[model samples]
Target: MKFLSSLVVLLLLFSCQPQKNASDYEADLIIYGGTSAAITAAVQAKKMGKTVIIVSPDTHLGGLSSGGLGYTDTGNKSVIGGLAREFYHRVYMHYQTDSAWKWQKKDEYGNKGQGTPAMDGENRTMWIFEPHVAEQVFEGFSKENELEIHRNEWLDRESGVTKENGKITQIKTLSGKTYSGKVFIDATYEGDLLAAAGVSYHVGRESNATYGEKWNGVQVGVFQHKHYFNVNISPYVIADDPASGLLPEISTNPPGENGEGDKRLQAYNYRMALSRHPDNRVPFAKPENYDPARYELLARVYAAGRDDTFEKYDPIPNLKTDTNNHGPFSTDYIGKNYAYPEASYEERKDILQEHIDYQKGLMYYLANDPKVPAEVREEMAQWGLAKDEFTDNGNWPHQIYVREARRMIGAYVMTEHDVLGAKTVPEPVGMGSYSLDSHNAQRFVTAEGFVQNEGDIGVHPENPYSISYGTLVPKKEECTNLIVPVCVSSSHTAFGSIRMEPVFMILGQSAAAAASLAIDQGIPVQELSYADLKVVLDEEKQILTQEK
Candidate 1:
C-alpha cells in the first residue's frame, strides 16, 4: 500500500509539474533576430497563411530601424518592392496625419533633401524619422497581422539548434525553452542562427585574389575621406615614434601585404540618442575608467582650428541628431572589436558595454572636457538623450549598428560588378542603390608616419541593380532548409550597399515567401524553381526588375 501511494504521488507530481523535455510551441517558420528583416519575414509568413514566430535576442522589434539609423541610406527607392516598400508606405501614412508631427508642423519640417514625394498620393518616402515612430510602425504590423513574438530570447547555437536530414528540427533558447519549426530564417545581422546551424560563412574581408574582384581586402593607397586629417601629428608621445609605444589606437602590424587580407573587422558603435530638449535630455556621463590621454589627438585636432568636426552630427525628425563617427580619433573605438563576429554572448555583452563606454566618454570629452575648444564644448552640450525615446533603457539605443559581420559562403555571392551595372543576375528578387560605402576597418601610421584609415569606399552604383535570390540560399549540403536574408552571400564591398534596413526588410519578405513555397511544394529551399518563385513574388507586388 505504501509503495502504491508513493508511485501514484510521483506520477501526479510529474504530470502537474509540466513536461520536462517537451516542446511548448511549434510554428511553420521560426525566425531568429528581431531585425527589420525578421519582422518582415514574420509578416510575410502570416500573409502566406503559414504560422510563424520571431524569437529575438533584442527586446525591441526593429533592429537599427528603431535603433537610431533614422536617416535612411536607400540608394534607389524605386527598386524597393513588396513588404519592404509597404513599410516605407506605412511611414508615409503615419506622417500623412496632421497629428504626426506633434513637435513641429509639416511645412516647418520642409522637404530638406528626401527628393520628390511619391506621386501615388502617398507622402513620398520620409526616409528619415524618429526611432519611436519606426518602432510603432513595426508594432503596428505585428498587431495587424497578429505575429507571435518572443523577445529577449537568445538562441543556444551549439547544441541548441537540432537538425535532421539537412532540415532544422528545433532550436533551444538560452532560457531552456525549445521552439520547433518546419523552416527557419536567420534574419540576424550577426548570422548567429545560421552559424549555429552549421552553415558555411566567411568573416573579415576576402582577398581580391580569392574572388578575382577589384576591391576586397586591405586598400592602402585609397584616401577617400578627410578622416585622417593632418596624419602627421602622431597620437603617440613623440613624433615618428615607434618607441613612444604605438599611438593609443593605431594597429602595430604592417597593413597586410597591400591586396592581401587579414582577419580585421570594421568598427561598431552605438547610434546614440540625443536631444536638444533640456527637460528630457541627460548630459553625456563621463565613463568609468576614463583616460584623458586617449583623446589628446582630438584635442590637438580641435586646437588646430578644426571647427568642422561637428558637421557629421546629421539631424533627424525629433530634433535629434544621428551622430556618427567621422574623422580619425572620433566616436569609432578603432581596433577594439575584431572578435565580435564570433564571440560568445557574454563576451559580446562586454564588447557592447565597452563600445557604449567609449562613445559616451567621447561625448563627455567633447562636451565638458576643459581641453576641448569652448565653442565645440558649448555646441556639444546642447545635445543629450531624447526625453521621449528609448524610455525603457535610460534613453540610449538598444541596438548597436552592426555595420558588417558574417557573409555567408552560399550558392551565389553578390559582387561590386553586380551593383555597378557591369553584370546582371538572373534570379532577381530585390534591388539596392546605396553608394558602395565601407567604414574604416583599421587605423595605422604610414611609413612616412602619417595616420591613415583604410577601407572607406563611397562609389555610387552605375544604376540600380537586381539582387539575386541565390544570394540568400545556402548550399544544399550545408543547410538546404535555411535562408539568410540579413547576412546574405556578398563581397565585403557589395554588402556595404545591401546592408541598409529597407533592403534587409525587402529581402526578408522574399526569403519568407520562398520558404513558404518550398514547404508547400515539399522541396528543399535551393530546389524551388525560379518560375514559381517569381510568380508569387509578382502576385505579392515584389519589384524584381527595373523597367527600361
Candidate 2:
C-alpha cells in the first residue's frame, strides 16, 4: 500500500510539471520573427488553409513598421499588392473613423510629397500612419485569423535546430520550447533562423568586382545624402592637432580604398515617434548614462554651418513625426552595429542598450545641451516623445531600425543590374522600386585631413523591378524545407531597395504561399514549380512584373 501511494504521487508530480522539451506542437508551416514579414507570412499560410504558427522573438509584432517607421519610404506605391496593400488599406479604414484623431483634426492634416493623397480613399490605402496604429493593424490580423503566435520565444542559435537529410525537422528555443513544422519561413531582420540552420549568408559589403556592379562595395567619395561632412572639420579632439586623438564617433583607421570590400555595415538607429503637441508629448529625458561630451562632433558640425537637424522629421498622423536620421551627425549610430548580426544574445542585448542610450542621449543633447545652437535647441525642445506611442517602453520606439544584416547567399543573388532594370529577373516573386539607399558605413579622416563619412549611396532604379523567387529559397542541398523573406539573397547594393517594409511584406506573402504549396505537393521548397507558384501568387493578387 505504501509503494502504490508513492508511485501515484510521483506520477501526479510529473504530470503537473510543464514539458520543457515539448515537440508536440506541430504545424504545417512555421514562421519565425515578429517582423511585418512574419505577420504577413503567417496570415498568408493560414489563408491557404494550412496550420501555421508564428514563433516570434519580440513581444511586439510588425518590427519597424509598428515600431516607428510610419512615414513609409515607398518609391512607387502602384506595385504594392496582396496582404501588403491590405495592411495599408486597414490603416485607411482606421483613419476614416473620426475617433482615430485625438491631438489633431483629420482635415487639418495636409498629405503631400507622396505624389498622391496620404489618405487615398479611391484605392482605400493610407500610406502614412502612427506606430501604434500599425501595431493595431498587425494585431487585428492575428486576432481575426486566430493565428498561433508564440511571442518572446527566441531561437537557440546553437544546437537548437534538428536536421535530417539536409532538411530542418525541428527548432528549439532558449526558453526550452520545441517546435516541429513541415515548412519554415525565416522572416527576421537578422536572419537568425537561416543562419542557425547552416544556410550560407554574407555580412558586410562585397567588392564591386565580385558582383560586377557599380555600387556593391566601398564608396569612399559617394555622398548622395547630406550625411558627409562638406565643410573642413578636423577629426582630432583639438583642431589640427594629430596628437590630440580622434574625436568621439570618428574612426581612427583608414576609410579603405574605393570599390574595396570590408566587414563594415551601414548605420542603424531608432525611427523616433515624436510630437510637438503639448498635451500628448513627453519631454526628452536624459538617459541615466547620458554624457553630453559624446555629441561634441555634432556641436562642431553645427558650428561649421550644418543646420539641417529637423529636415527628416517626417510627419505622420495626429501631429506626430516619424523622425529618421537626417544630416551629418544625427540619429544613426554609424559604424557601431558591425557585430550585431552575429553577436550572441547577451552581447546583442548590450549592443541594443548602447544604441538606446546613444539615441536617448542624442535627443537630450539636442533639446537641452548648451553646446547646441539656441534656435535649434528651442525647436528641438518643442518636439518630445509621443505619450501615446510605445507606452510600455518609456515612450521610445521598441524596435531599432536594423537597416541591413546577414543576407543569405542563396540560389539567386539580386544585384545592382537587376535593381537598375538593366537585367530582367526570372521566376518573379514580387517587386521593389525604392532607391538603393545605404547609410554611411564609417566616419574617417580624409587624405586632406578633413572628417568625412564613407559608404552612403543613393541611386534610384530606372524603374520598378521584379524580384526573383529564387532569392527566397536556399540551395537545394543546403536546406530543402526552409524559406527566407526579409534576408533574401542579394548583393549589398540591390538589398538597399528590397529592404523596404512594403517589399518585405510582399515577399513574406509570396514565401508563405510557396511553403504551403511545397507541403501539399510533398516536395522541397527549392523544387516548387514556378508556373504553379505563379498561378497562386496571381490569385493572391501579388504584383509580379512591372508593366511599362
After superposition on all CA atoms, how large is the RMSD of candidate 2? 3.7
lDDT of 2 by residue, 1-548 (tens): 99999999999999999875455578999898999999999999999899999999999999999999998988899999999999999999999999999999989997743667788988999999999999999999999999999999999999889999999999989988888999999999999999999999999999999889899788988889888888888888898998989888989889888898889999999999999999999999979989888898998999988888998998898899999998888899989999999999999999999999999999999999888999999998789999999999999899999999999999999999999988979999999999999999999898898898988999998789999999999999999999999999999999999999999999999999999999999999999999999999999999999776
Instruction: Name the best candidate (by lDDT).
Output: 2
lDDT of 1 by residue, 1-548 (tens): 99999999999998898564664668889999999999999998998999998998988989999998876777677788888878877877787888876656666664443344322244355676778888999999999999999988989976889999998889999888898888899999999988999888888888888877677788887766666655357646675566877656677766876677777777787777678767767888777878777777788777666777677666665467677778867887767788898999999999999888878878888888899989888888788878788999988899988999898989899988888788878799888888887777888777777667777667787678889999999999988889999999998888889999989998999999999999898889999999999998999888888854
Q: Using Cα atoms with residue i matched to residue i, what is each candidate's TM-score against the true structure?
A: 0.93, 0.96
RMSD of each: 4.0, 3.7
User: What lDDT does the true structure give each of the candidates?
Assistant: 0.83, 0.93
Q: At residue 158, what lDDT does model 2 achieve? A: 95
- Model 2 compared with the native: what TM-score? 0.96
Give the total clashing residue pairs for model 1.
3
- Pairs in clash, predicted candidate 2: none
lDDT for 288 in candidate 1 is 84
